[model samples]
Target: MTMTMTMTIAGACPGFRARLLLGGALLAGSALAGPAVAQDMPAPQKDAAPGLTKVASFEHQVTGVTVSKDGRIFVNFPRWTEDTAVSVAELKDGTLTPFPDAEWNGWRNAKKDQVDARNHWVCVQSVVADPKGNLWVLDPAAPAMAAVVKDGPKLVEIDLKTNKPARTIAFDETVAPQVSYLNDVRFSPDGKTAYLTDSGASGALVVVDLDSGKARRLLDGDPTTMPDKSVTVSYDGKPLRRPDGRGVEFAADGLALSPDGKTLYWQAIKGKTLYSLPTDALTGWLTSAVVPSALTDKSLSGKVETVGENGPADGLIISRHDGRMYVTAPEENAVKVRDLTAKGGTPTVLVQDPRLRWPDTFAEAPDGTILFTTSHIQDSAFYKPDAPAALPTELWSIKPGAAEATGSTTAPK
Candidate 1:
């Protein structure tokens, strides 16, 4: 069976006007952009940490950020609202330049089997750098969060030495289904395998065998990967909802891997629970002919385990030095650090900053400084048509008082 889906713009969609009016009335006094300032907007809330500083700002919404071993910064802005002139950019000397070249950043419309699509970034959701200094760009090719074009979703690897694309790994429907929104990814220590979260229609973990360029979708529709419908997201004391009256419900968003490459951690954006599983269980299933029923069967011992979290979380990272898991709790406007080795200990606030509107991703620099991006997605035009003009997305960095550690050099999951 084959299926295709696409999402229309806000005004073009049916009943959008009515939805917009209702949304505007509900969000009447909410402050999204703050005073329509010509200069940089003031911090929504102050950072509790003293060392936090701004690295760069973008007019477009930036969801993912990663730093290379040499301290080179790269960020990705997904094509969620208006088409972005450049989806992926490199931050240098306080300015962003289209990565590699502008041609690769150019993607206008969805084309079926377009060869050039591999070169262009189509709705790139995340940017990550590997341990070997190679940058990987994951493009779900689902513009406006709609249906994906045929042969559009892919992972492009770029060699930093040459600043050119080293190879492209295209994903078929089996790996990235029509409704699949490839969210974030983390690589194995050896850089041989990558695990990604599908936060869209069908939530699952996608395991990619880099050597063979084969990708497999695992644990599809499993309880751990699905969103808990009962959980409601409250941003700034109000229920975070879209113009259509639907709350933000993303599933299986953040992902992380243990330093030893033994365990993988993941959680849904709309959920308060966190989960982990043995890496071997995922890779081992890839080689087995296990049916869907058997794979999702809870009775099948040695499956994933739940690691309960504080609240709705976005980005997740396990510190290589101490094995502490750092999670971004947007509801609390704080980052929570959990000791994975502890048996049911409460998460401690690593950094609580009112400026963190929607802390999305994390990238630990070689010097032990942690970098993250804030998109303020809850205030995006998709949810609030009357939202003030888009504010510049921010990139921030702070040192968590930890020495440099060894592990995969991927972006925040």
Candidate 2:
């Protein structure tokens, strides 16, 4: 098994050890259950924050969550420790349906030779519902988060209205090296450019031009994208690590874009300092004719600004309602928000609950509700051998407001 991200505490034991990758998902039914109700998955998380309500539960582990402007929820599962049956899905009437179709998610580890990895979702890392009414899927294509599948890493755009793939931008070894695991993504308001985080062995930011289908890597090997050596991902006031002394080392995993689409924020999972840079600076060079990668990388590095610090985090999103950035604090089982308008904004705790085990990704619903998934990284099979391969996870949400004390938990349809 690959230990690219997420879950459980396996002490340094003698046996096969793999990746501890990251990803969170949600839904109302078991992955094996059809048209499920709340009963299909685990019950409500006890002691969850006020107004926090459970939406869906999945039998397979989940990492990313997104809501279309029209309110359709889509989530993705990474092939970290288990070969999940479905890579991406949509929640409709309390059921998880293979998004786009089963064919796109038909690739399997055991059946790798039989299926074309380039054409299917080998291991989907993130899914985003764009402002332009399209669904974009980021496929790192590294099953078990190990070797890069030849011709597998790509970004696909699906027309939400037609529910069909409208475009596919493939990534080569240069953009998605074998050691890289593209973690999360955000798009410019007009959907012209895309930003992604590389949370694999090496860290970097990948910029994609939607129109030209050309992509570039920026800040590669830089301290901002790479993990910070000083920070420790702690839980219960202690560093979260594997039995073998390995700690959470995901780099450039969390990301956010300003509502104006001018500033981009990202940080490493193994690091704490938040960083940002002007979108114009990031995109201008890409639009220019044939600039050398070295020059572009160096110029972009100079523009990088230290935003602030957030203890090791996973998912990040800027709320459209308040114009503030929301971050997932996995170690504390909480979510925090920072005001960009402030000169040096310090993030304040928004909510904390024991149920929010490794809160992963974030999405704003049409009604201004904040949705996220509890990836439960410290309690998954990746670290705990006895833990079931199909780790039980859930999607949850709350009304975004400082004064909002109570919300609904009666399982959304």
Candidate 3:
């Protein structure tokens, strides 16, 4: 696995000595209360029972999931609202085992005990595997939205074989001091560049030069980058608002690089519009004067089509063989697909079940079966109640048939 560490943080661990990596930001508010309801998925498929084979499940709530090039599944659990012993694990031989033990996880959680700062691992927003087979773990470093600009907020890269870190990326007071909860990251097809989304308090795209190890935020709060206010996102049945009065807009959660590697598409959790830009325009290396002449009128750069108007939007993946884009729209209790090439047909509805309570991430297997996770988030203490849930959160899979494929094929990256 490839490990990356650029900016240095005082308490940050150099590598992955354990399974869990914890980050906490202290914001004022009462600590969230206890055991959430056992949330359940919607009813099974009606016709053929759209076979949903469970790959794995964890006792702690799972937020993000990803698969390595070799097909090994890596999952991360942020030590956020819940009291947790471990933060990350791997599914091997159909069983979940700690990829790294607690010592490593504890180091991730440690913070200054000074009266002004509180220590805790808030949550892990993204888990991604690079082309070189290294796993990149993004730790938002701040717990609960308390702004910790210095000695906090980092990205840790771990070697899958040794479970050790190759590098750590951090920011201090000189950099933007507010919380930079680094979210999803995607590698260029050539693997020469990496683009990360900052879904933190300051929403922006942080572009990193992999070869040079340089990083900076771009489209910083630009109109195209900000979230739209008209869209309301619900998890199960309730809207997901920050504990504070501010509504959760510009979540900047779901990210995808087009098959050609020229366009980067993104959507906010609280946004209804889908926006994209030429990769060259968002790198921050070019000033408006030097920006490509082709990069003008972002609204004309891409069109934002309406997906179902419900629930929060999370992970997104584009199929290599069929040119279809799959997204998780958890409010409607379903996983939806849009044919990128369709001229005017309605987007096909893939799976919409109550069981998919709060589906977060989406990954397509080599064979075209879509894999995703269900958090039952709307039913959780963070969003809803603390009682026995009627349904269980599960990992679900759906296989696409030959008819799903169009006449064209995606060129190899």
Candidate 4:
């Protein structure tokens, strides 16, 4: 049996210390389920702020969402649970059709050698569309957050116009290592480089060169990428913990790129602080003659800058229209917007709703609509083993005042 399955079985046991250790180890190791108890869940705020609308709902947990320039919506459901049939799918006319074809999504139970890991979507964490109108799928290759499949981790680029995969870039140990979990990714304005967050056993930033298909790991275990053990995430006015007594902890998640492709913004799920750094510093590390195997806090001392945020955040995105950064603050069940151009400016609540359980990722449409998904992560099986079997995950879209004012028709990079 897999370690994840063992952990799941052991976690359900009644011992306090053992269960606690198992749960904590599970949380430290990686980052799950169900039902239809709608009445038990918090009710949607009747007076929810305007400009918010529900675009779609799903029975499975969804954490990553991206919309193409032409308004083609795509979502990804991680294999944290047992029932994730489709890793990457397109939402068309209220139905989800597996992107490319069903054959690519049919590697769930196949043996590592029997399947073409590089060509198939083993376990997709995020799907993003670039400024050039191509969709890129990120697969960490670890199902149920277990061991990484051989030659499994990869970034697949698909041509939206043809709805067919254009290329596949497989990542090896140097870039993705056994412990690496590629959580989220953002592309540079020029689409030459891709920045990804490693939120698994260690925290780091993985930079990929699109032209050469070469990837380098930087800032490995850096303070900015690592989770602050001192910080505790709370949800619904209580410390967010698993039934086995482990606290929720995730490192180096949610990434956003500046309009000019100079600054990269990122934060940890278990941490309250936000951070940004010059893209050049990260890209420069690749060419350094004495590039260390792992970068320390001191190595990036002057290059990394901490940005103030209201609380812990998940998915983060910068608005192309107004140049503001939108952070999903699950602690307050609200989305906060900060003016990137204004120094020392505080983030303001752009929208709040009780139904915003845990907003995961952000995507901007050509029509000035900002799209996001609420996975209700705190209520998942990872935290509550007895969580309902049919939870409702929602995709929401809102046109903030900033987006409406610009009326920009440009696509997000």
Per-candidate local distance difference test: 0.73, 0.77, 0.55, 0.74
In order of TM-score, best first, we have 2, 4, 1, 3
Question: Which is the leading candidate under TM-score?
Answer: 2
Summed backbone clashes in each candidate are: 2, 28, 29, 8
lDDT of 2 by residue, 1-413 (tens): 11123222122112212221211322322231222221232333455455566666666789998988766778888887887767888765334567788788777788534488767898898999888979999999987778988889999999987999999999997789999899899999998999999888878888999999999887777878998999888876688777777878888999999988999999998888889999998887687786546313676788899988887888899988778888999987878888887756568777777777899999887656788998888877555667787787878776665214453222211
Model 3: residue 235 alpha-carbon error in angstroms: 5.0
Give the per-residue Cα lDDT of candidate 2 at 53: 60
Off by over 4 Å in 1: 1-48, 109-115, 289-302, 388-391, 402-413
True lDDT of residue 223, candidate 1: 76
Candidate 1 lDDT tens digits, 1-413: 11111222121213111101111211332221212211121221232355454555566688998877766778887888766667787754334567877678767653442336666888999999887879999999888788986777999899988999999999988888898899998999999998999998778888888898977888777878888887998998899988789898888998989999999989898888888889987777567776445235554334778776657899998876567888888887777778888755567776666667788999877655677888888778877897644345777765565212221112222
Query: Clashes in model 1: which pairs?
Result: 5-147, 45-355
- What alpha-carbon RMSD in Å does predicted model 2 have with respect to the real structure? 8.3
lDDT tens readout by residue for model 3, 1-413:
11211222123233222211111110111111111101111222233225443444445567667666655566766644553444556644333445444345453334452221112233556677776778877666554335543554666677877877777665443223465566778877787677777665556666677766666666555544456667776553456665553455545678888777777777777766556667876654533444322113344334433333323477777776577777777666666777766443434556665556678777654445566877665665554445332223455556655213421112222
TM-score of 4: 0.83
Could you tell me the lDDT of residue 6 within candidate 1? 23
Supply the global lDDT for candidate 1: 0.73
Model 4 segments more than 4 A misplaced? 1-48, 110-114, 295-297, 388-390, 402-413
**Candidate 3, residue 7: lDDT:** 26
* TM-scores, all models, native as reference: 0.82, 0.85, 0.72, 0.83
